[model samples]
Target chain A: MKQIFRTIAMIFVLCLAASPSFSQTGKTETYPPIDSDALEQFGGPEGVRNWVESLFYYIMLDNRINHVFREFGNIERQIYLNTQLLQLVLGGNEVEYQGASMAAAHADLGITLTQFNAVVEAAYNACERIQLTYEACNLMIAGLAPYKHAIVTR
Target chain B: MEEAKRAKFPVSKGAALVVAMLASGLSQAGWYDSGKVLATGGVSMIDGAGGGGITPWATITGYGTKEGINGDLHYTYAPLANYTLHSLGAAVGFWDRFELSYTSSALTTGSTFDTVGLVADTLGGVTGSLAGTPINTGIEPFNTTIEMESIGAKVRVFGEAIYDSDNLIPQIAIGGFYKNNKNEDLLKTLKADKAKDWEAYISATKIFFPINTLINITARYTAANQTGLVGFGGPDGSDKEIRPEISLAYLLRKDTVIGIEWAQHGDNLEGESVEIAGLDLTGLQPTLEALGLGNVSGTLTQHESDWYDVFVAFFPNKNLSITMAYAMLGNITITPDQHGFYMSLQASF
Candidate 1:
């Protein structure tokens, strides 16, 4: 038994000794870069900012309604509503109509800088045809919707 | 006087067998002190063979480490046809580096025909031969039951020897444990005393995260002193053994791990013949002295084995975990073939 244990120990030591070389040499794959320049031309900073403002207002409105009426409290429902609103406003050049109200509401809710950047990214994709439609907007809204609860609770 | 000498040898032989078996079994089982307290930055749970280091990785699972303290309460239960054993233990850490623990267990071996059979004839002979009634005619129904209890305390000390940026750290630890057992009627019948055993051990674990999702390997070794249950025989016969262990763990998720380990123990040592101090007229002594020729007092000599274990652990949150393990005993000499499976849940506050 002692001999067996010693052999097992030696095997483990050798494996431990060999691991570092494998780890050090293994190549780390990187992700494809996001094109910020192409993104800027689609909406410029102002257009992106306006789209973000609108999305925030929709999120806050949904949170208020869900807080008051337990049946509508689902975050997914809020995301659906935000998607529909973004579709109607961004269908053409209707950005000016909803931009100010959305921006004011988000600012009032104390949205953090990180969250604001996320909102801008989402809006830029929505307007530049990257997202291109209400269904796409809804997907983005659903993805960002969970963050609303986190922000509010924090 | 002849009977007294005869009795001495068998008792001594049995004691020798027990010592040899225990030393061999434990060494194979990789007996050791899990150096490092509950708060120390090492493995948090003890494995099936009563050893430590269940695959070390860079990510810390429990609250115990070199800088803080952690404590836990655990229970184990195993039931067989004639006996049932239960153990409850508690461990605590000091300054995240040193650990102290205590465990108490109760073993209840139900009524036995062998013990009853021995008493019936011995008692019948004592009474009938004096009264001139045949001993067999005087025999009557006899009942025998046995219960055993054991308690142990352990302490472990551990620290890091090398630390690197890749999260690989080499650490070593030393620990000691003392165990005491009480058996109600068995000791009295065998003319033996309670059992006491002490063990000290040292081990090292070096964690290498050569791969992001795997903990390459961990190894350990331990040595301990055997306990003699047969009383007044040979200076309290003790044996020493060496055991080495190795294990590998792969992370299924950040909070879950799976691993397997193998360990083996060295042979038992032959020691000097024990003195049967006060008992008189027993035929057991000479038989024992004859077998003492090859014994060594403090080192390993004969009878050893090896064991294998597979285990899994789940960490649902930062302060709680559950583990399951199975072990197979191999090359046993005096004891029956044994297999054990265990499940344990631990939480710290």
Candidate 2:
């Protein structure tokens, strides 16, 4: 019994010892801190293009939202159009898109809040995968989170 | 031997009042809520409880988000060098308050005894049929598998492990498993104190949404020998030991998680040749010396080690989940680091 306690105590100590190094690396921020604005920090339309491309790749691999990505035909064109729309929203180009409302586009798909969360999570992971800075990734997540009400129907 | 007295955890008056009110008012409620998110119920553990592959956490089973009753049926197949394990079990959660589970495990040690020459080794010169001496009597060819059953129950005290990221408070649960091993004759011969033993545990789980990860830790006190596969506390003295286990999973998708788990096992079986080949032998040395098997040792399982696995769980939908894992059963008994494949199919509603 004492041996077991000793072993458990040893493990506790090890866990405590290892925890601080991670916190020190300073990735603990939930969202990135913005200096000027999201698009300016993202380096304009081309930068947003790479981020959207990587984000879409992760979403396509995610089982929960992948169906929605595939069901939309001409994925490459759709991706191009969406990126353009994002640029327009983030003050990039004066592009015009007769896009479907988020509600109308997803109302038939029965997207749950959980699925929307997964999409958001994928965006976060994609930010890291694309080597976005702490502030840039956080900004993207913050920007995308507002669309949950539009994207989730169920 | 019986397990130690159950550990007690304090239930705050407010929490107790809430549980009592719900139980009294919500008995036999129909069509439960899908508790938590998808695949958040966690995959079934080896003991048939809800959690990771080998450790049971605080998560309730099913999609019953916290209001209705949910049940799960699962079957797991694991192949190892010495034995193959097949477990079939089911678990049910009521109003996300209490959980009950049961699983039957079959471990086939086929030719495992042969590998150690256990049955063929000289058996104290008893007048037996084969070779005019009793066989090792451990287990012969066809009857290689040992069958055991486990019944488990857990109660969620408070908090949310997966969904609630607002507070630092983790979800806490207290649970116990009652195990009955069927091979009483084998257990008796091995000097196990009892054919039945139990394990009691308290688990805490928390989700760090910022990191997209969930971590659970369970501290278990158990008297079962070799997790009750070989029976309970042996002649080595009937005492329980605390074992700690942890499972950490990262959500790659809301419906998919990839994780690693670590669990340690205790050697509850008493050793006979405390020194022989490291088997902790008690008193069978002289007879073995006469048989030219003096160098052989560890007649019963003596040393124990930790188990680890890297696994991925995928949920195609809310009701179905599949888990695939590669396990490292490090230095269990006489084996080196043995590696194996584990797969389980779970249906929950």
The prediction achieving the highest DockQ against the true structure is 2
On lDDT, the leading prediction is 2
Give the lDDT of residue A17 in candidate 1: 74
Q: In order, what fnat does every candidate score? A: 0.00, 0.01
- The ten-residue window of minimal lDDT in model 1 chain A covers A24-33
**RMSD (Å) per prediction:** 17.7, 10.7
**Residue runs of model 1 more than 4 Å from their true location after superposition:** A1-154, B1-62, B80-83, B110-169, B184-194, B211-236, B263-305, B330-335
TM-score of each: 0.44, 0.64
For residue A12, model 1's alpha carbon misses the true position, in angstroms, by 19
Report lDDT (Cα) of residue A152, candidate 2. Answer: 64
For model 1, residues B81-129, the per-residue Cα lDDT tens digits are 3334455555554333554544555544344233323433453455446
Residue B172, model 1: Cα distance from true site in angstroms: 1.1
List A-chain TM-scores for all predictions: 0.27, 0.68
